[model samples]
Target: MRADAARNVDAVLRTGARLLAEDPAAGMGAIAAEAGVDRRTVYRRFPSREALLAAVFQAKLDSAQRVLDEARLVEAPVAVALHRYVEGIVPVSRDWPVDVRRMMRADPAASVRREEQSGRLDRFVQRAADEGLLRADVPVAWARATLDHLVDTAAHGFPLIDPPQAADLVVDILLNGVGRR
Candidate 1:
């Protein structure tokens, strides 16, 4: 694609995301109108509505990367790290489908980021285990998997109040195993 074509595509994708955040059912025509691009260009760039939406979502997730960075999931204690994880993920949780799917998809760039996230979470879990703060037998990989599920829920699961009521409880359940000592 030419430089102008790439710029036009990015513009359309940006417009589509802005519209979709307000209304997921926003139409292709509306997006094209917003971007001042023709319908042919929209279809030519994205091929399908889902593909376009996916691109919009990836952009949103990219914008959200700093939350994970601030959480310091790999730098802090397991329990505190888990709490920060909830705080980090809740904002982006509003648009769960796009965020969760794009993160989990096997795209090389996304995967590298995901692995970095996993490694950070792992380091925290390792520290917690060493401190006897978590179940010593809990595998770092399992902790990472549980976090992924929790974050995905924060994203894609049923909605509730703003900031989400169940996040702390769910994180607690994951860390504590929900059984009597």
Candidate 2:
């Protein structure tokens, strides 16, 4: 693809993520307008609203994969890896607000990617338990679920703060309870 076209596609996907996040029923024309791209350009690239949404989810997944790689989950200490992952993911969740779960039926490939990502997270959570960062008595699935919720809260509940800052708060909360110490 040409440089200009790639830029246009990026713009459209970003705008689509934002608008669709605000309102799932957002139209293609509205996304094109917000993206500052011609409607025909978006149409030519996506062909349909579902196609565009699938692409946005794919973009989010791609960003997530990069974050996972950068986090070095297998090599880094569990605490450090957790912070890195949350910091990287918070912005991704903010930028590409469309939930991949919503796109699963529309895009099987995206569903597969999501499952792979989830598997990695689950393994990381298990590693945390093995490393004594998390309690071995607790179910690994529960810890993983809690971590997922905490990240979502950090990303959406406190959108005003920078992701790295939010990541600190998230990691702290994950490691320590809110009750009095």
Candidate 3:
């Protein structure tokens, strides 16, 4: 694409990622304003609200994967690492990458992203079970789905006036649910 087109793409990604994460009800026009672009530009790149959200969602997922990579989740006990990773999802809420998880929920490619995370998280759970820290019958996919559900819930609909405390509630429940007895 042209230089300006690339810039527009990056801009929409940045804006969509933020407002959408902070509030799922955010609209494309707001994202365009944040990007310093017009509706025509936003539509040209994203085509529809769903399309824009997809790009935003993909960006977020890719970023989280990179964080997962850099944190070296493979370096620690799989259970400990995965729990901390999922918890990170709550406080880690900030910009586009965070929006990826949030937007993907409504975006068309959500199942694809879900499957991708599911596979990766499942591997981690399987490793945890292998290490005898998790129940042997615990399904890896279920663990992954649980984490996804928790992170998004904690991100958007935390109960307390304080978001952090609400996140804690989620993390504690997850840890307890999967904790070895």
Top candidate on TM-score is 2
What ranges in model 3 sit over 4 Å off?
A: 1-11, 17-30, 34-36, 40-51, 91-114, 136-141, 159-172, 177-181
Per-residue lDDT of model 1, residues 68-95, tens digit only: 6776766766666667667666665553
**Tens-place lDDT digits, model 3, residues 18-104:** 777667778888888888999888987788877877776776677667656644566876545655575555544545444343554
lDDT of 2 by residue, 1-181 (tens): 9999999999999999999988999999999999999999999999999989988988999999999999999999888999999999999999898876787777899999999998999999888888788766789898888888988888889889998898898888777756797
**Where's the lowest-lDDT run of ten residues in candidate 1?**
94-103
* lDDT (C-alpha, whole model) for all candidates: 0.68, 0.91, 0.66
| Candidate 1 local Cα displacement, residue 65, angstroms | 1.8
Residue range with the least summed lDDT across 10 consecutive positions in model 3 = 92-101
Residue 41 displacement (Å), model 2:
1.1
Model 1, global lDDT: 0.68
Error of 3 at 39 (Å): 3.4
Q: Which stretches of candidate 1 lie over 4 Å from their true place?
A: 1-54, 74-76, 99-106
